[model samples]
Target chain A: MTPSSFVKLDGVAKRWNGQLGVEGISLDIPEGSFTALLGPSGCGKSTTLRLLAGLELPDEGTISIDGKDVTTSAASDRNLSMVFQSYALFPHLSVAENVVFGLKVRRVSKKERQVKLHRALEITGLLGYERRKPGELSGGQRQRVALARAIVAGQRLCLMDEPLSNLDAKLRNAVRKDIKKLQRDLGITVVYVTHDQTEAMSMADTVVLMKDGHIQQIGSPDDLYSRPNNTFVAEFVGAPPMALIDATAFASVFDNSATVGIRAENIQIVPSGQGRLRCVVTESEFLGAETLIGLDHAGASGLCVLKPGLAMVAEGSEIDIDFQDESLHVFDADGQRLTG
Target chain B: MSAHANLERRRQAIYGWLLLSPAAVLLTLFAFYPSIATLWSSLFSRGTRRRPSEFVGGENYTDLFADPTFWLVVKNNLLYAGVTIPVSIFIALSMALWANSKISARGFVRTAYFTPTVLPMIAAANLWLFFYTPGLGVLDQIGSVFGLPSVNWLGQPETALWAIIIVTIWKEAGFFMIFYLAALQTIPEDLKEAADIEGASRWTYTRRIVLPLLMPTTLFIAVNAIINSVKLIDHLFILTKGGPSDASKLILYYIWEMAFAFFDAPSAAAMTIMVIAVLGVVAAVQFFYLDRRTHYQ
Candidate 1:
């Protein structure tokens, strides 16, 4: 493990009855950085978070947090807190009671508990909700309570497992900013797990995309979006996803086995018989500010072009789309990114 | 429009009454009428062939107050309620927690814990009857193997109520456990995980989270256990018939004796009225007080 990494996992592997839960996992998280484990459901993003939280022990390799080996440490012994997807606020407990639960468990003095609880509640904007039971609070308020509880202990490391998944869309957006601000203000290292690309891209300093029990790519959001390491990352990390085109279509430039990838924003919808490749408009989705025009081609999947304004293109209309040769991401037959 | 609104209101009123009619009819026929009839009968004197039944207000109530046997049965039931309600609830809670854990043979364990509930109470009493049958019983057989004396369980005043209490607890704990198990499952596993991360010990989690979450279930089980202490006297008939000296005589058993064995219907009716009043107050207290404090999801 690197000395500079605040939390490090060295070749960590976990399994369920000899089946692959997660394998050959290695990561180094710096202090006070937001790292999101992003993937589809059942992609072991949750397994990775649980392993880091010390909730699940890996079958092989070591996990270290804050430069200490916590491979087999109990969750509490690791001195880290967690925010569950369900919020997990004790239903019978008031908001103040839930926030101070960890402090009380750690036997912190009454005065200190009160001080910390007050500060945590204030930071989460839940000052007036202290006396409310979780059941009595709105979904957004309950989420803040979970956040307050996670931070009340002043643990330097916080693990959040899709904490905003339970909230509605508008509340999710607000809480997203709140959580990002909270992490920034506290300077706490966070390991967040999410299946939502928007959440990961918008908040995380580093986004680790995984597929089928293995890390596909680990980099900044821009790195995953602009330069995906594999075909899966290309398709999984964007809003509309990157389009995949068979290299055979670009007969002169690419190897027959290679696949070419391009973003919708980079592809321009030129007039028919003028652009490089011909495509038929499959569907058009008007997203207020911009309309996304989905295109269908013989050798491509997820071909789309972003048109500004309500560009209602008719379905089955032939259109020619073009992208600069430099913008094309070339992946070999094995689906691994090929360096220029 | 106002007429249409009135018509709609009338339709809604009719729908509401239609929905409530079944319950109202059942209660009036079986519960309300019987309670009022019992009260009316309690105010009258039992009739012989020579003298017809006559009004004797407060006489049967006073006679019950003067009866030593009634006091003894009341005391016996009080002790029974105190022991069986708490003990059975405690056992049920423990059994529920154990069975809900991730253990091997979990299905078998749950089935074993639930077996007593599946058996009829009389059949269960019969099964315990074999265990309390002096020299030929299971308890005595085990005692003898340990070189201990085989004492008569059902025939003695001191041990008869205790033996019945044990039987009631054994038969009841399993039934209460099913409710506890259902309540336990409703408490999400996430709470335990959250507690684990909070540095709370397992016992602390149980006390702070699990136990409080189970308050509604505990209150329900307590009410059922109290009612069963009085109502489930079927075992008394099969085991001791309210015992050698009325030692195991619960209030319901004594009431049955007053009505059928002694043919004193008025006194039995008075006792039943008292039972109903006490139960009503208790149910009201539990509903009003504990319901507000409980967190139901």
Candidate 2:
């Protein structure tokens, strides 16, 4: 209901074949911001995107775009555009033709459609390849064609479902940067779906983390990464996931049924007696610029510590573990963060 | 160059031939040899077996070109292919879309539509003959009950070919539909959703996205439809038998009558050669059309 709000889902629910795909969910995507719905497969992230795209109607509640109720509106009338994961370019159409398909469908004049198609292709850096079919393009190039098709429509809202997942790592990185740059330049609101937390963290203005058909935490990427609300978010957001340790081992550090979370890079591996906990190194992985020491502690859950340079200790080598008191996140029996 | 190199090359050639021997033998016996024999036979006179005949190269072809009956049969074949291919394709596309939609009893409906495809074409031809009977037939009965004139469905020259075309379309549309259905199903759901969000109307999406993507399947069905129309001859036997005025006659029926009914073996062989040539041309056109469109996915 806010002025700058571009899309809103109110009590939206959807089910398929008697199974709950998405439960009552309410959220808003503001204008001119890139947001990502990040979740694992079948976690209802794609389902949420489908509902917002008007591809699937919510079983309960309403959906709105630009403050207009469009819950029952046909998908064709929704004034939105989407890029599919498959990069679903028409195989028989040239790149320019694919980009102009929406305009042609709307009966736009040929001259106008041509101008828009060229602009879209140029923006996507596909200017010289207008006459080529999608089959002739590489995976990354095909993805750009899909992007161009969506961009040429110039709809108020754009939805992308794992658009870069099909590209190789190198192309994915390049396309990811291109997507963020294009979003900033165009000021178009985008609701991107990706299972890659890194994609969400790097490209999204706001990240909506979902799990099992429910929204886990919706916040800026840094907020979700640094101050996750539950065990799920804490574990889901970071690469080389946050190390969870039994808080009871350090009874002085906690007052209740013990739990503590530390990100991989947060836990420091000091000399054997510099910290409160004593541990034995189990395994170590030498990543460039950092070494992840997998350790075993007495009366505590296993921990993976990111230390500078090569292995500070060999397997079965006794090592001291330490984390700043303020950096250690303490949680209760139910995995909710507990305050001091 | 060297003895071992030569030996290895010979071994590869032997293995290659061994791998291809079955297909090569079958093609020579069934396709290549028969076609050559038919072409050779077409160059000879159609005299009785007791009298030795002399070669008359291209005479059969000249005679076929000159004959009004042969031209009429060719025209009939073209009419059959032209009408049946387009009409059946249209019906198949429509039926595929309808059956694929969120219709209640979709499986049952699909089964019902496809049931005719499995029935023997000869048996189906006989069944349609009963329906086309004048006055007391099912079609006539239905027409008379509505106070419409009960016209002879297949007896008349003007209506016989049309009646055959209708039955052929009805019989084959479902078979063609299964191909279209498979093509339709292969189109990613994401593409359809993308079109919908682009504000493309249903017709626009189908025309621009669905149809073009299914081009391969369309060409496939078209080639098969033409082949089936030209080669198959069940309807002629039950309904018109080359018609009141040879109206419902197809090339195959004419060939049958030429060889067996008229006992003109060389003429029949010549006509058969022509038919094969026509089929080859049609097949070649399809091959090129398909070659250009194949996505190599």
Candidate 3:
């Protein structure tokens, strides 16, 4: 009911056979914003995207697009376009034909279809490659073709399901930036599904973190990383993910918290006698711009700190590390954030 | 190139030829030799009790061209092919779609549709004969229930060839369905999901996406169907025996009658050569024209 809400799902749930695929899901996507449903595999992120695309029907609750209930509408009737994980370009069709497939299906006039196809292909940087079939294109080119196909439909909302997963690491990074820029330029609502946190963090205006068919947190990337609502979100949102420490291990530092979380970058290594927690350096890895120091203390393993430049501490050397007080995240017994 | 590398290359060539020798030998003996021998023999006259075999030099071919029975059988075979190929393919596609769907008793339905494929051609022909037998046949019995006259399904020239065409389609469609089913399964489920989201109707998806994707399979099945139309004469033997005044006499059955029943070897050889030439033209058209339109990937 919010003024900004364009696409809304109210208590939506879907089941495959007798088992639940996604349940009790509610979300409001603001118009023209890039949103990401992010989770590990089997986390119901894809099922949610398919439900929104109208490829799968929800068993409960209602889905409304622009104030119109479309819970029972056919996928074609919903007027939404999607790019699949496999690209799913018609192998028999040329890239140009693939892009204009939706227009042809809708009986759009030839002149309009050609205009849209040209614009889409030009935007996706696939202008001259339009004559080539999908089988002839490389992975990144095929992905762009899928993107061109989705955008050519001129639908207000577009869904993408791991569209860059098929590309190489270098191509993935390039295409990720292309997609982010394209979304901004086109001003279309995008619901992207990704298991990779980096993709979600880099591309989304609002990242919806999911686990086991339920949303753990929904916020901006910075909000998710700095102020995670639960242990799951805290552990999921960042690279060298935030580590959860037993509260009892640091009794003096934590009084009532069940779990304490700290980012690797926030742990400062100082002289052994000046710090609160002391541990022996176990391993050190030299990454190009930063070095990561791994530490183990008393039976609990897992303290990794990122130090700028080459800082190598010899193995078995005792070191003292102090947690930055502002960066410490405390959680209650129920795994929810314990706010002051 | 160095001498050692050159020797190794020669060795590899010999090894490759050695590996291919068995297939080459079988093809030469069974296919190439028979084809050339048929053509060569068609140029000679059949030996008789008083006259020894003599060089005919196109006489047999000229007689074959002038023969009414030969032309009639050729016409019948062409009709059989024109009717069977497309109809069987369409039915096979439908059967594949049904078998691939999430219908109840899906396993049983697939097995039932595929059952005729494993049945012997003669056995299938005999079974259909029982169904087409005038008054006692299943079809006539069903018709009689509606008080419709007991029609002669295979006993009259008007309906005999059509009855043969129907039975051939039934026998071969299930076999063709297996190929179509395999092709259908290979299509990524994501394509269908993508089509759905792209706002394509089911008919549009099948026509534009599914059918185009299936072209390679259709081409493959068409080649098989064409060959079967010429070679599968077991049904003709059991059902009509090219009877009702040769109304359903295909080229292969006519060749058999000419060669064995009437002992006209030279004429039969000429007819066989003609059939081979027709098949060659079909293969050429498939490889050159249809293959260009088929998307292999």
Candidate 4:
């Protein structure tokens, strides 16, 4: 592997009692980059992270970190740290003690441990709370403690499993920025596992979208959103996900039997008899700055168009929606993206 | 105050008392009344057929202090508590750790470890009685196979107390293990995974994380174990019965012997009062002192 590939997994597969965990899982993460394993629950995102952390062994293939084979090694031997979703702070230990526990175990000098602990806590904005136990801290403060603990060891690689999931929405947004900034400033390679697409897209430099224990696509957030590999990725990557139209509905446009995919923003409300397709306004949702007008068509599902503020249309009103031919995405019968 | 407010306040007072009455009545009937009655009777001489009973303040207690058998039982009990409390707790913790790990037949292992706890103390004592019964006993039977002498476990003075201690530990450890197991399950699995990623070894994880987290349970089990050291002497009745020289006697067994076997009710009442006082003090210390140091999740 090249030096850019700081961590690599090749043909990693894990099965429990003949049940699939993850199969043919291969990935390469560059140094000092943020890669997110994004998927819904039971899609093996966490399982892949666990396998890379050395918390679980793979049934096949190899994992190497910093050019060293570490597939069979213990989690500790692999030289990494992780933040759990529960924030897994040692409940009895004070913030400082929890952060420095691994250092003490590693026989680091007390002075060095104190230095590292102070730096980590300061970075995580938890400086004054070092003396407080986890039980005494707020949920957000406890989560910061978990972050401090993960960073205190100064490992080159850090893994985070839905670390912000337990926090409230406002706090999640703030911590999300803080984590991305932490990864950037520290120059650490971070592998984050999250079910929230917004978290993956907003924070990660590379998003590896997965489904049903297999990778759907591995690309930059823009790539996944703009050029999805399959129907699952096309629908999963964007908000108000991409809508699909059966080929028969648009048989006059394309001769091959394929599905048409289009983004919500590309579809517009056109005057009667002038639009490509006629649709009815089913419902309209008033967002703070915009309104999402839901459209119903016999040939389409999840067809909606974004309109400017306060665009309330009465339900059951017929509206014609039109889109450019070039903007449509074509997929084969198996849902694989078809190149023109 | 307004008449309506006053009426509401009176109703709340009555409601509060109604909530407390069940516990108040139970404690008075079972604990408080019995303790006061024991103290009252302890100050009097035991009544005889020819003589009426008369109050002899603190005389029964003085007689107990003068008795050699009382001191012997106290010493035996101290030794028993000192040895069995730590031994049983350690065994229970070890067994709990082993059984909690990811192993094949985990359900069977847990059930096997918990079987002795499910059996009643008297029934378990009888089951061990067969093991301690001199020649045909399991201990001697195993010893004979190793070409060792078939020594009497419960008949002799030195071995008799130890024999009782062994049965107590065996019976008590399994019961304590169940508590440890329950406490272990409350600990999140991700904590261990977090520890492992931090490079903590199995021993370090146990000592630093597992042991500290289990402090509350340990404190609770310790109080239970101390109370049990005084309370559970049923095995002594079956296995050693205060023995050839009162070598295997515990304080409770001596109290039972004083009241029922020898029919000296005053002495038994005095001893009973002392036992309650010691246990009450221990419970107080556990709540006021040790509870502060223990961590609850």
Candidate 5:
């Protein structure tokens, strides 16, 4: 364990109704770093966040926050704050009252509560909405109110469970940037939970990819994208995931019992009979900046090539495509990456 | 084109009213017409064997106002309402919290709580009658084991109304609990977790978050309880018969006795009109005052 680790979990496990929620999970989150628990639904990303927030107690393990074992402690004693996906703002209270609820519960002085409330509202861009009820606010405004409430509580560790999932696309982007900026400015450690890879990759200092109650990989977004630990991480980290093909199909490139992985962007098209492999275009999607051509190679589906700048490739056209050797990822038969 | 659009709108309005006519006609016949008829009759004198009915404007109301029994029953009804509404609502909320919690045999507990609601008020009154009966009653039998003297629960003026109030509360609380339980279920679980993470104590969370969120449900249940208090006079017919000097007689019970037992329709009609006016005021207060404060999605 690193001496600088601010939060540590050792072999944390949780079971719900005799089924594993998560098991054998260990992590060391550094101080003031923004880490994201990124995975698909039901992959225990939210469960991990809940555990850190002390909402759910681990069935097996010790959870230490700043060198204090809080595995058996109540959530209220954890000295953390959470922003929910539903916002969870008190509907009856005005925006100012909602933001100051934690301070009031702790019996903080009225003056200090007001000062913190004002600062939180200012940070979240909700200063003018002090008198509006949560029901009176828009989705984005409500989300900001929830953020302001968490910030005003002044907890050093803030947990957010898919907080931006409720907003529309444009508003989500704006709020995402705002949350990132707020975290950096406050120097508070944040553990964000998200199923959206784009959200995790764009905002997090470290992305902890999980699947099926296990951690797949934990690293910077570029590390996972450039050198995935396994086939799952390779496919999960990118925009359009990397394609896995049989090693025999690329026998001339390498003679090994492995799965050949190549991203869509690394496959280049050339004149027929000139490149290493020949294929026929089955479908073409024109996405303005790039055209994705779906190719049929040796009965393998989803062998796609992303061509830059509106390349027009008609259906059933014969084409030669070659993999970028330097960019190719080789995974062994067990699906583990063969090299760093 | 404008004429065509106008014709289309007229046709749509006719269709709308056509669909609503059945319920509208039923409400007029059963609800509106009776209220109007009762008000119209309240201004007149009751017909007797030797004399025809006469149009004595405000005479029935004047007589009603002068009657001490009328005032006493109104006080009793108010006391009954004052006791039953808040106590029953509090018990219902507690019961809902229990039923919604992760307790053993939860389904059985919910069913047991709701069973009293499903039982007819008359049958429930009969069941309670055995419990309130002196000496040989279940309550007295239990008291005897504790070496306590037999107490006449429904005989005295002070205890008679209270006994009836207890029975009404027992019956009505379970029905209101179903509403509270449904509302509690609709509250997101994440809110509780969020409260926990915010370092709010359980009591604080319930007061600041849970209870405020439940205000709409409380209002809804309160309105139902008010209506039930007026309509639920069936137990009185079997339990106390408003007995020992009309001690437990509510407005509805007195109105029934005046109309059927005394055959004084004008007096009964006047009391009925008064009841309707009180209910109208309550509805207005609920709609204009409370509704504005409630948050609904």
Candidate 6:
């Protein structure tokens, strides 16, 4: 382990009722980095977060924080804090009380606790809302209160499970930027869990994609987006989803009967003869700045091309869609990456 | 022009009133009538022992004020409420926390703690009366084992009320535990986990997080325990019967003695009105205290 390794999960596995919940997962979270555990529901992403939080004991392997074995440590001894998705504030307490609850529990002096509570409230932009109950706050405000509570604990490591999932889309976007900026500014090591791929792609320094209790891939967001090691990562990381085509038809493009993947933005709809592949535009989605065209290729099949918003392609228009050979992604029969 | 629509509207109105009238009448008959009657009765006076049935306006209230026994019973009620409310709620909270802990045989333990709630108070009082017997009783036997004095619990004026209070706490703590358990379960596991991660010890969590979160339930159970302490009289029947110089007799038991033992109906009615007045004040205090705190959810 490196000296900067903040949290390290070494060969961790968990089982319940003779069923595997997380199996042989290993990763190192560097200090002061914002990492995201990204996967579909039931993919054990939340389970991995819970394991790191000491909410669940691993049935095998070991977990450590800053090189200390914490597998057997109680959650109270972990020196970490978590913000739940539900924003579980004490309903009976005022906002100030909720934020200072941890300090009070640790028997900190009331004077120091008040100082820390004020600082946390200022940081979370909840300074004047301290007198109100949680029931009186909006969902976004409640989330801020939850964040304030976590911030007041002063623990170096913070775990968040879908913290912004409960907010409206507009609020989610705002809080997302706020959280990312806060994480970067505070230099606190944060491990966030989310099923929203966009949330992971937009906020993470390192993204660990999980599937069925196993670590599918662990890399920087740019690395996973630009050079996915498997078909699952390729399919999971991008929006409008990576259009998949059977590579067997394009014999010159690949040497095997593999699945070829290309991001929607990579494919271009060009005039015929300017491109190597020809297709008919079946449908089009006109986003504000770009238009996505769905194309039906003769053999490769189900190709989509993203074009500038000004491109006006009528229905049933014959268009040639193309990408550079280097931009092609090839995967074998089992969805394992063959070529980047 | 729309006869059927008119009939339907009429049907809905009739059904609404039909559904409402039963409760309205029951409340008026059982809840409202006695209250109004008690208030009316308080305005009357107690007659002489020979006639015992004359009316002089507000004279009974004045006589009640002059009677030292009335003030003593009021003091006893306050003591009972003070002791039982805090003790029962504390014991219930502790039991609920224990029953909800990650211990072995939690279900069996919960059932055992809750068993007293379902047992009749009269039966429990009878059983305790046997245990509080002077000699050859289980309590005295245990006291002898501990090398304690063989003092009669209910036969002494000093200890009689406390003995009854102890029995009341035992009888009602389990009943209140069920409310506390429900509230405890409603507290999401995440808050507990959050407190744990904050380096809070178990006692700190109980005192800061768990107890504060359970405030509404505490208020609820406190009100219930207070009401039950005021009204319940099985202990008065079995162990003390207002004996040892009437030190253990509650206001309701005193009213029962005045009405039946001495056959003084008007004075019993007057005392009954006084008890209701005291209870009304306590109920109002609870209502306002809880009203300010009710979250409505």
Quote each prediction's TM-score: 0.97, 0.93, 0.97, 0.97, 0.96, 0.86
| Candidate DockQ scores, in order | 0.81, 0.65, 0.81, 0.84, 0.72, 0.52
lDDT of 5 by residue, A1-340 (tens): 4646888989999999999799888999998999999998999999998888888889999899988899989888888888998988877789999899888888999999989998999898888999998888999999999999888877888999999999999999999999999999999999999999999999999999999899999999998889899988888878778877777774446656478788898888887777866788899988899988888888343578998888878999889888767778888878898876
Tens-digit lDDT track for model 5 on B1-297?
999999999999999999999999999999999999999999889998899898999999999999999999999999999999999999999999889989999999999999999999999999999999999889999999999999889988879999999999999999999999999998888777777777777788888887878889999999988988888999999989998698999999999999999999999999999999999999999989999987775
Clashing pairs in 2: none
**What tens digits encode model 1's per-residue C-alpha lDDT throughout A1-340?**
4545999999999999988899989999999999999999999999999998878999998998987899999998999999999999898999999999989988999999999999999999998888898889899999999999999998999999999999999989999999999999999999999999999999999999988899999999999999999999999989899999988875547654479899999999777777889999999999999999999999999999999999999999999988898899989898999864
The lDDT of model 2 is 0.86
Model 6: docking quality category: medium
How high is each candidate's interface RMSD, in Å?
0.8, 1.9, 1.0, 0.9, 1.4, 2.0
How big is the positional error of residue A323 in model 3, measured in Å on the Cα after superposition?
1.9
User: TM-score of model 3, chain A?
Assistant: 0.96
Which number leads on DockQ? 4
* Candidate 5 deviant stretches above 4 angstroms: A1-3, A252-255, A299-301, B1-5
Chain A TM-score compared with the true chain A, each model in order? 0.98, 0.96, 0.96, 0.98, 0.96, 0.95
Task: Mark the regions of model 1 whose C-alpha exceeds 4 Å error after superposition.
Answer: A1-3, A255-257
| Best of the two (4, 5) by TM-score | 4
Model 4: CA > 4 A from native: A255-257, B1-10
* Local accuracy of candidate 6 as per-residue lDDT tens digits, A151-220: 8877888999999999999999999999999888888899999999899989999999999998889998
Residue B196 CA displacement from its true place in model 3, Å: 1.6
Ranking by DockQ: 4, 1, 3, 5, 2, 6
Q: What value does the lDDT take at residue A239 in candidate 3? A: 80
* Superior by lDDT: candidate 4 or candidate 6: 4
Candidate 6 Cα errors over 4 Å, as ranges: A1-4, A107-115, A249-252, A268-284, A294-303, A310-324, B1-25, B42-53, B62-79, B129-163, B238-240, B244-247, B289-297
